[model samples]
Target: MLKLVVCVKAVPDPEKADRIKIDPVTKNLIRQDIPMVLNPIDKFALEAALVLKEEKGAHITVISMGPPDAASIVKECMALGADKGILLSDRAFGGADAFATAFTLASGIKKLEEFDVVFCGMASSDGATEWVGPQIANFLDTPVVTMVKAIEENEDLTWTVRADFDNGYRRVKVQLPCVFTVTRDLNTPRTLSFSGIIKARKKQVDILGLEQLGVDPEKVGAKGSPTIVSDMEITSNTRETTMIQGTLEEKADAVLELLKDFGSIG
Candidate 1:
């Protein structure tokens, strides 16, 4: 059976984006007041793994790193079809940048003993740095394809995929034991079912702290992170409208000039 690992994250529900806040001191999101759901794109990654499992019997493991509350999303992934769930939670892991987070996740994956494929979202809805997946691949010393929109399994050792680029997409043939950061274009994620939830009741979400993963505490959390946020500000969205009075052709020319003045277009 193929062994697959999908990384998931709990993010503030986008529906409540207006209510989200940032901690001025910690330079991290203030999530306590906001509802948390699986990172939007991460569901696509899980769905991709589930589709593979349905076609060929496979063991699917979902891993997440966040506060204790993140276990909720881990359970949700199990209810969606994962065989096992692992949560890496510790106070020390707070405020981690992409590099530290990937290093910690890579360490946890190493503890899994064996894995043929690893999946991650192209980026988190909140962070949107799009660096974690590639960084994880670097730490694991494995091949990685980002923005993967389509995948086809070949022999046990090889797989084919289409990854998005600037102008078009690239068809790639990669070996097993590779990492893929999938995009939402990959697949439609299924909704959670009651029966799946019941099955999850019998399944457990194992929580692993820094020590449990046998990682250097200094290297796996905020302390190990090299980047620091100096400041952050909420952007104002107030808009001003102007009326133009002229002939149709004149108005069109005026709009083009305005766009050029604002650098909105060349």
Candidate 2:
């Protein structure tokens, strides 16, 4: 049997994007009342793991790092078919940038039994930096393939996959114990079912904190992060509407003149 790990995130609801705000002092998202949901693209990554479990009888462990509420998303993954869920939650783990976040997650992963494969979304909707997956692989000292669209073969210790490239896609054969940051093209995610929810209720979600992982607190949050937002400003967009008065031909000429004045046309 294979052991697989899928990394998931609880991001602020994208539908409520307008309500999102940034903290001027911390340079972090102010998510006081915002509802959090599983990162959309991460569903594809979890789906990939679920498919592998169904085909080859593997155990899938879904892991994430966030506040205590993030366990809700972890349970959602269990309802969707993951075998186990783990959430790394602690106030010390707050305000983590991509590098710090990945480091913390990698430390948590090291506590698990040796895993054969690690899957993650190509990027998170909130940050969209597309760096965590690769950085996790770097910390794990494993080969990484990003933007994976399909898994052509997953037999024995070698697997073949198709990944997005510069303009097209490339096929790659990778060894086991590798990391794959998947794209939505990989597979369609399954929805929750009543039976799955019941099963999830029986399964426990292990919550680990910075001390549990035995990682340096200074290396797992804002203080450990190398990148800092020195300044941020919100720019307002205002549009001016002008009414054209005259015959149809005159209106057309007027619009053309306005376009030229705005540099929208030559």
Each prediction's Cα RMSD?
2.8, 2.2
Which candidate wins on lDDT?
A: 2
How much does candidate 2 score in TM-score?
A: 0.91
lDDT against the true structure, each candidate: 0.92, 0.93
**How far off is residue 137 in model 2, in Å?**
0.4
Give the per-residue lDDT of model 1 (tens digit) for 38-132: 99999999999999999888899999999999999999999999999999999889889999999999988998979988999999999989999
What is the TM-score of each predicted model, taking all chains together? 0.91, 0.91
For candidate 2, what's the RMSD? 2.2
How high is the lDDT of residue 8 in model 1? 96
